[model samples]
Target: MKRVGSFLGDWWRLVIPYFRSEEWPIAIALLIGAIALTFAGVGLEVLFNDWNRRFYDSIQNKNETVFWREIIFFSWLAALYIMVFVARAIVSPYLRLRWRRWLTSHYLAHWLDDRGYYRIELTRAVDNVDQRIAEDLNQLGQYTMTLLLGLLGAVATLISFLFILWELSGPLSLASIGIDITVPGYMAWVCLIYAVVGSYLANLVGRRLIPLNFMRQRFEANFRFSLVRVRENAEGIALYHGEKREADSLNARFIDVFNNGFRVLMTQAQLAFYQSGYAQLAIIFPYVVTAPRFFAGVITFGVMTQTASAFGQVQTALSFFIDNYTSLAELRAVMDRLKGLQIATDEKPPTAIEVMPQPGRSGVATEDLTLSLPGGQALLENLDLPLEKGQSVLVRGASGTGKSTLFRALAGIWPFGRGRVRVPEGARVLFLPQKPYIPIGTLRDAVRYPDENSRASDADIAAALQATGLGHLTDRLDEVAHWSNVLSGGEQQRLAAARAIVFKPDWLFMDEATASLDDAAEATVYNALKKQLPGTTMVSIGHRPTLRKWHDRQLELKRAPGEVGTLVEVPA
Candidate 1:
């Protein structure tokens, strides 16, 4: 019960926002309309129960006029019933889509807003964000609709039909014990007991499914994510001859999927055994209980028929939880995932090394700067540095000395220590890593990324491409393809350099950007940058000794035991 309440509490957090937003009026009206239609449908059901008694009486008496009159009445009742169901079906899904759209956009905005996406990927290293957005939000909205609508219908039906059932099954005695247990609503009490027992038993059979379902979804998403990662990095994996290892890893994840799925099947099987049996036995149980009253002539076949319908409705209402418990559990699971994503995205930046980029054209400046890891291992501590326009510096260090990490700090991404960094506000700053991100779009857009609407002409973009010796791509800018996979490693780096040449940012930082390029190709690109953008300042972190000629100065990092961070110095 506590767990279920907690689940509902999370669901409310997810659900309540939509009704309170701008859609509140329409959503409320549609909900009220749907509920009214349902009540009308139930009203028709109660009238039909009366018709069952009268129609059965007419048939027993062999009266043609009464029978035909009742047929006409039922035809109208059937049409009314059909209209009610049709109205609900039409209006409910519209509401569902509205709610889903609002929630999807809300989550999408939160996930992508203000560098949350990059921070989570780099800092937390949590995988499968795409799955969380695409799959989890969709399922959360869909299941929330299903559960809410089901609960509304169940509650309405229970209230309307329980009274009918109390009137029909008559005063009661315990026949098994032959004792007078004089309860006015004995049949209602009987139903309450039966429903409570069935629900309790069903909970026992299905209680483990909630966590299992949650794990299954996460596992499935993870496995799918791995497959996509392999596809995206197929060339890298192939170059490393990692197909066997990849297959083994993928198979291990799938095995968990298979085992979890099998467990769910077993559990559902257990739940089904009880549910189906209860429904089947329900067919005869009401008749058996009221049989003595019928034989004593206290009621006719008509009453017996009406009484049976009322009993079924009551039992159906009572058993709703038993039937829907599993789905409710899954609904909660999806809610939990969305909540997790929200929390992960909204977490405050670490207070230690977080550097804020200030607005200036004074060039990149840092005052009393310190950078540290989240674990408090200093990358660079108590360091002060200034680089202005036309200054090119190379940051050099042994591997794992946090050369790249300090660049992240300057970019305001690695926020684990205390520092202040000042840079030109609204100044175009670009970071080109060892491998550039090739967005899946036209080559032109990918090259001009983070500058999607830049005023750079096609001729200029084309000339930049030709300068990189990728003249073939000069005419293919408008043509769309996955350029990352289409181009070779060296070619992609050349393309990345071509972008830097094209965008001509005031400041450009490259972290091992030429590691994959040969010495000749690397030198050609850096020399081209100097010729093309004479005023642009480039800070590069590279291991190649040949790179020293392109830069006027170098900041080399030193790491030692018992030391927390890298020490930086400007070489003569």
Candidate 2:
């Protein structure tokens, strides 16, 4: 019960916002409409119960006029029922979509804000974030609509039918069954007991489904993620001829999915068996209970028929939870995943590194800065470096010696560090990693990314591409393709350099941004930047000795065994 309460608390946090959001008026109105339709449906059921008694009485009496009149009455009732059902079907899903749109946009903002996407990955707090955002949100919307409407309908049906069952049930005596007992409204009490027992048994049979569904979602997402990974790296796998290895890994992931799916199927089968029997038995149990009174002439055939119908309605209303156990389990799983994503995205990282703007500063500066690996091993310690405007510096260090990490710190992304790194106020800074992220879009968009609506003239963009040795792509700016997969590594780096020229930031940090190009091509790219953007300050990480002459000064990171590296000046 405590666990259920906790689950409901989380559910409220997810659901209440939609009804109180800017879209609240429409959402609340639609919800009220849907709810009114639900009760109208219950009203139709009660009307049918009355019609059942009259129709059956006419049959027993063989009265053609009464039978035909009742049939016409039912036609109108059925029409109204159909209308209510159809309206609810349409309005309920519309409500779900509205809630879904708001929820998807809300989560997208949080997941993308403050680099939450990157931090989530670095912390590894949640798995399959893409699946959580895409599939889980969709499931949440669908399941919430189903469960909420089902519950409301159940409550309305119970209220409507319970009174009818109580009024028609009369009384029962157990003297003939070797017991001396009398009960009032015995049929209503029977339904309450039956539903209570059935619900308890259903909960027992299906409790394991909660965790099973959770694991199934994870397993399916894992398998899907593996397939996407393989597709993204198809070129590298083909180059290595690793199809057999890839196939084995993929098959193993599928095995996890299959095994968990089998378990779920088994549990569902158990639940289905119990629920089916319970329902089939309900159909006959009400008739059996009322037949004795009818045979004793204690009631008319109409009374017996009405009593049975009301009993069925009451029982059906009470069995709502039993019928929706699997859906409830599935909803629980989705809620857990979404809650986990929310917590992870909202959490602040523990590291104490701080980056802020210093007024009157012209370039980047680090004071008493220390950096570490994600696992807390020191990478660089107490390294103070001052970079002035219009100066270019090349940073060199051995592989795994924190060169790229230092660049990350300077870019204000590496959070696993301490102390302060300050940059000039209102300065435009850009970081170019070894592999530039080329979003799947047109060449013009890729070259002018982070500025989707760049106003730079085509001629200016074309010149930048030509100067970076990518003149062939100048005319294809509007052609859309997966540019990252289409371009060679050297061409990609040159494209990034072209992007840098278009951006024209005040400070540019490149972490081996030109490693893919040949020395001559790299020199051409750097020299072009020197002649065109002479005021831009540059910090670069590279191992090539040919890169030394482009920078006016150099900082090399040096580390001894089991100690953090320190940055020192070196000759250019």
Candidate 3:
């Protein structure tokens, strides 16, 4: 009971937001209407149970007119039932869709806001966030609709059938059991006891399903994510002839999925055995209990049949949780995933690296900066550097000398550090990583991304592409494709250069941005930047000796015996 209570509490916290969202009016209205129709369906079921009694009694008595009249009555009831059922089916999905759209939008906003996605990656707090937002959110809608409607239907069935069961079932005197008491509503009591015992047994058999379902989702997502990773790195794998290795890794992940799935199937088979027998036995148990009265001439066939129908309805209502145990377990897992994602998204990035925007201040500078790796090991400490306006500086160092880490600290994204980075307020700055991000879109969109909606002119874009030696792509500006996958590594780097020509930022930081290109091609990009954005304060991180001519000054990171690395000015 405590576990169930906790689950409901979590479920309510995850789901209540949609009901209070801007779409709540229509969502709530549709929910009420659907629930109302469900009750109407339950009421129609009661009418059918009563109709069964009269219809069968007329047959037993060989009455033609009454039978025909009851048949006509049943036709009306059936038509109304179908109408209500269809309307419910139509409206419920529309509501689910609307709710899902709102939730997906909300989650996306939260996940993308303030670099929440990046922090989640750094923390590793949750896995397969893509699945959580995409698949689990969809499941939330599907299972929420099914479970809520099923519960409401069950409640209505119980309300409408319990009275009929009570009146139809006479008091059973316990004379045979050597007791004097008479039990009223004996069939209702029997059904309650039967459903309770069945529910207890079903829970015992199915409790393992919750964690298995959770692990199954994780394993399946892990396998799928691995496949996506392989697809993304297909070129590297093919070049290295590592397909066999990747295949083995993929198979290993899938084996986890396969083993867990077998466990789920085995447990489900056990549950199905018990539930199937319980349900089939329920069909006959009511008649068996009422048989003595009917055979002893105390009641008619119609009454006995009506008692059976009512007992079935009541028992089904009471056994709602038992029947939906597996689905409920899956739903629990889905809700837990979404809740974890919500918590992760809400977490703020570390403030260890502080970025301050100083209005009217030109260029970028850092004061007494200390940076550390994620494992609490210091990389650089007490580092101070100041860059004046319009000066091109190149940063060079051996690998593992904290060159890229310093750049990250300056960009204010490396969280495990203590530093103050001062950037001129309202100044546009851009950071180009080694492998540039080319969103799957048109050539123009990919070049203009992080600012796709900016008011850059077409002539400007074409000129920038031509200036960066990508004149061949100028004609394909309107073509939509996965630009990253379609373009070669050198071409992608050239595209990043073209972006800089278009953006013309006040400051630019490049971390091995031209590593993929030939020295001659790399020189063309640097020359284009020097010629085009002369006043832009540029900082480049590279190892090529040929890059020295473009910069006015160079900063080199040199390691001491035991202290963090030191930054010193080197002759350009």
Candidate 4:
């Protein structure tokens, strides 16, 4: 019961936001319309049940006139039922789509706001966030609406038919068995007990499905992600002739998917076996129980059939949980995943590193800054580095000495550290990693990335590309393609240089951004930056000796084994 309550609470938290969103007026109106159609459909069932009694009675009495009239009545009832069903079908899915759109937008904002996505990746807090946003949110909206409307319809059917069934069932007498006992509304009682037992057994048989479904989604997503990774790195793998090894890794991931999928299939098979048998038995069980009254001449055939029809409706309503247990389990799993994502995005992890903005400050500086690994081991300790405006600085260190991590700290993305990084207020900063991110779009968009709204003219973009020796790509600026996969390493780095030239940040930090380029091309790119963005402060992290000449000063990180790296000023 506690677990059920908790699940409902989580599900409600996920659902209620949409109804309260800016689209609430339309959302609520459509929901109300869907619900009205559901109840109206249930009302049609009651009318149909009454028509069943009259139509069968007229047939029993051989009254062709009344029989024909009931047929006409049934046609009208059937028409109304069809209309209600159609209306519900239209409104419900429309509401689901609109709700999903709002939810997608809301979650996207939360995930992307304030670099929450970056922190989530850094901490490894959740798995397959893309799946969560793309697939799970859609499923959540779909299942929640389907289940809620189904449940409301069930309750209405149960309430409407319970009274009709009670009145029609009358009483069961045990006088024939020598006991003087009369049970009133016996069929209603039987239905309640039968449905209760069926639901309990269904839950018992399918309880494992919740975790199985959860793991199934995870394993499937993991397998898909592995395939995408292989595709993304196809060049590296093909160059190394690692297809056999890649196949082995991919097969390993699929094995997890296959094993869990098999478990789900088997479990669903068990539930299906029980559900099918239970449903088939329900068809005749009502007749079997009500036939005695018909045979004894206590009720007409019409009364007996009406009693049976009412029994079926009441039983179906009571057995809603039994019928939908699998869907319930799946919805629970989706709720758990979405709830976890919500919590992860909402979490405000204590910041060990503090970044402050000083309005009049000339450049970026760190005070008592200590950088650490995720495991809390210090990488750099007690570092006080002040980078003044327009001063080109080169940062050099042995491999794995936290040079790139320092860049991340300055960019204010790395969180596993304690420090005060003060940046000049309103300063435009950009960090270019070794392998720059080239978004999948037109080359114009890629060159102007992180500044998608830049008003840089095509002529300016072409000039920047030519300046970086990528004059060939200038013609393809409007050509749309996956630039990251399409361009070579050197070309991609040059493209990154083109972006730097085009955007021209106030402070530019490059972590081996030019490592892929040859010395001549690299010098050309650096000279272009110097000549074009003369006032920009440049911080470069590179191993190339030729890189020193472009910088005004140098800082080297030196450390012994098991000691934190300390930054020292060195001659350029």
Residues 1-572, candidate 1, lDDT per residue (tens digit)? 79768877888888889889888999888777767776777778788888998999788779899999999999999998888888888887788778778877888888888677877886664556787778887777678766777777777778877888887776775666887566686778888888889999999898888889988888898789789989989989999999999999999999989999999899989888989999988888889988988899888888888888888878888898898988977876787778888887888665644445566455787777887766677767777778776879898888888888878877777766776877877777888888888888898887787676787788988888887768888878888898888999888898898899888888989999888888888888888888888878999997779888888888888877447665567655
Q: Please identify model 1 stretches exceeding 4 Å from their true place.
A: 123-127, 173-181, 352-361
Best by lDDT: 4
Give the whole-model CA lDDT for all candidates, comma-separated.
0.82, 0.89, 0.90, 0.90
Candidate 2 residue lDDT tens string, 228-284: 999989999999999999999999999999999999999999999999999999999
Clashing pairs in 4: none
Predicted candidate 4 versus true structure: per-residue lDDT over 470-530, tens digit per residue: 9988899889998889999999999999899899899999999999988999999999999
Evaluation by lDDT, superior candidate among 1 and 4:
4
**Every model's TM-score:** 0.94, 0.97, 0.97, 0.98
Residue 373 in model 4: shift from native, Å? 1.3
lDDT of 2 at 470: 93
Q: Candidate 4: where is the Cα deviation over 4 Å?
A: 560-562
Model 3 misplacement above 4 A: 559-563
lDDT (Cα) of model 4: 0.90
